[model samples]
Target: MLLLKFFGANVDWTSSIHPSAKIEYPWNLKIGPLSSLGEKSWIYAMAPITIGEKTCIGKEAYLITGSHNISSNNFELITRPINIGDCCWLTTGVTILPGVEIGNYSVIAANSTVTKSVDSWSVMGGNPAKFIKKREIKNA
Candidate 1:
């Protein structure tokens, strides 16, 4: 992952990124200290993707920062930033869509698809992820 920094990715040296994780547009990617990207995860950073400190993205998670605008006759590509805040956990198979801001300390359940911004400390699940509960960090 150190090589990613050479390509303009703002990856912290303390971060643990699995070798199998695929990252596109490295220049647009930023990973904070002690964060992790699990094995086989894919990050399509057509815009910017910011993963905050101590966050964990589980295996096979997919983060997409671009999509086609079907409403346009030419099907133009639209790009947006994905911001995942501190201490968050995105479980296995979670799919985070474009322009979504997952707030600090949030938890995204397995296989959830987040289509919009999530509140801080929220536990969200299901497709187009809905708020299931608040994350209570003991002794935090």
Candidate 2:
């Protein structure tokens, strides 16, 4: 993060960004308020990655922005967008593949491979990641 500090990247408190984290194009990796990115996390950005307010990305989590073309016999590669909505928490070792959009107030369990879109207010786990349950908030 010395590069970010050197480049004058804006990081707000109530948020923790590890020193070992690698963010490709820190300018493009737009983080809203109260968000945190963990240590050794790699966020590869060809397309933009937008993390909404109060979100947390766990340690060593890989967010791949690039993908491959299935129709092409030569197996051409492509890039897909990733958008993580507000108040979400992504646990350690979670791999959020290309073109995945996770909605608000959701939690992805550790070591889960998210190949599909997860709905809002849901809890997901396992390989290829199925929905475990939904999150219910209590009104005060």
Candidate 3:
């Protein structure tokens, strides 16, 4: 954790990042308080990846912030930021692509590939993840 801070990662001290989690471009990553990045999660922070407070990124989840523009003659690399809002849950093996903004309290199911933004309180699943339902918390 000290090493990550030394590398300019803006992670809150209260956040829990597993030892095996792989983070590239640590300077571009920001994890808020009480967030937990599970073991073996890979964060490709080519641009910026922000995980809000109380969020949980499950084991083996992939947060990728870059892609190649195949149409370009040089096969140019395109980078975009990924934002996961507060109290969200990204389950195991989930892949969050570039430029995605997951709203507060949303839940991304295991093995889902999210290609676009998700609304607040949404429950998304499947490849190219679709909205399965809205998450309802009784006391929230």
* Better structure of 1 and 2 per TM-score: 1
lDDT of 1 by residue, 72-128 (tens): 999999999999999999999999999999999999999999999999999999997
Query: Candidates sorted by TM-score, descending order?
Result: 3, 1, 2
> Per the 3 Å backbone cut-off, how many clashing residue pairs does candidate 1 have?
0
lDDT by residue for model 3 over 20-74, one digit each (tens)? 9999999999999999999999999999899999999999999999999999899
- How high is the lDDT of residue 18 in model 2? 84
Worst 10-residue lDDT window, candidate 1 = 131-140
lDDT of each: 0.97, 0.84, 0.98
When summed lDDT is taken over every stretch of 10 residues in candidate 3, the lowest stretch is 131-140
Tell me each candidate's RMSD, in Å, in order: 1.1, 2.6, 1.1
Better of 2 and 3 by TM-score: 3
Residue ranges of candidate 3 with Cα displaced over 4 Å: none
Q: What's the TM-score of every candidate structure?
A: 0.97, 0.85, 0.98
Once model 2 is optimally superposed onto the true structure by TM-score, how far is the C-alpha of residue 23 displaced, in angstroms?
1.3
